[model samples]
Target: MSKLFLLVFIALSQRVQSFGIGSTLYCYQCVSTQPGCSPFNWFWHWSQACPEDGDTCVKVIERKGASEVVTRDCLSALKGVRTDIPADHYEGCKPAAVDVKLGNYVFSSIKELDVKKDYYDETTFCFCSFDNRCNGSSSLKVNKSVMFSLTALFMVIHFLILR
Candidate 1:
């Protein structure tokens, strides 16, 4: 039958070119400065004094200057706090702080420190595009419906191998 319709049209065009090769999007960042305060300040009373199982400080006093004193936590203020993967997949603005790793969509940040006048709280990890952390979008719509049902089963085996 024409070699089984050229081996099912070359195996459905190599499975639709391997589903258009893997897609990706991950991010991370954090800034905290305080040298006379006002480095994009917005602590809002230390994020309402964080507590719900999230808050492990060593030095917390984001502002109390007379000579100098503006500490923070999460290990020495900030400086590239690990985990990063950002080539600009999404983020229009509002990335002053982010940390949404829910279900492994990944996103982390921390860097930009120097407190003394009191101004430390600038976490980051932003990525948006329907903000699901950029998962495979339903596995690319189920691999485009299995590459259009394998291109209609290779056009019905090329019309029964050219009849």
Candidate 2:
């Protein structure tokens, strides 16, 4: 009936509305390597570190031709590495170590400390309704109930009119 159609339309119009807000946090951890070393040269290359924590150190080596072997120190060379907490609640990157130097050539007679860097990133999302009246939890509940009632009333009216 016309009344039924009207009720259905009203009910459909009163739907649960939602919106979202998001934020992200980033952190970097640096692992120091010999000068001119590239983290990408290695299999896994990512950069990540704990913002609050200092930096992390990682050792790396480089291969030249087929026989030449090089050793070097890499600092926070990885990219998109994650060192954040509460893994499930948020998303972040994880860093890995990479050997950048190739061929055994000792710059100094003494062995230098090898180090790499790590980083962390975070993202968040908040969802809410568009209606100003549905700003808070209680408001949202009230709005939902009101919407349902209006839809039901409209449907009843439509049904009676059609009949």
Candidate 3:
């Protein structure tokens, strides 16, 4: 009886270890409308483990005349919105447009050219599957070199004007 119990325990432990093979990905979860969380403070929101089949983390930003909305969630959470990203959807950000008739989703380098005015002034979706908390920030960041040059130019201009 002792031998049988020992073997059974070993088998069960192995099975349990197998269950832990696939690691779950975590993502930031938040909404711009959440009270006391406006303006998107990194500390205000929390990270949540994605669903079993959810491998993508998405951050959606929508801008109108003067209002903007930001949303961060597991891709699976936005299924109701109906943007069907194919399995081959590339990683990174792009202007998002939805088909008015079919309601299908598409992307473009320029938002205003592709998306209808009713959609918004701009809508961008950043998709990532490579890292945890990947959807936390905008994908397209200004080049440091460009910023440095711009700052130097501004200083030169200011000094020249003073003289």
Residue 68 of model 1, lDDT score = 28
lDDT of each: 0.34, 0.31, 0.64
Over the stretch 118-145, how does candidate 1's per-residue lDDT look in tens digits? 1434323323333111221223224556
Model 3, residue 124: distance off in Å is 0.7
Estimated TM-score for each candidate: 0.25, 0.24, 0.54
Error (Å) of candidate 3 at residue 28 is: 1.0
Better of 1 and 2 by TM-score: 1
Query: Positional deviation of 31 in candidate 2, in angstroms?
Result: 30
Tens-digit lDDT track of model 2 for 1-163? 5656666675556434322112211221222242222332322322232232222223222232443222221123322432221222222222222334422363543333322211112222111222222211232244566666877786676567556
Q: Which of candidates 2 and 3 reaches a greater lDDT? A: 3
RMSD of 1: 17.1
The TM-score between candidate 3 and the true structure equals 0.54
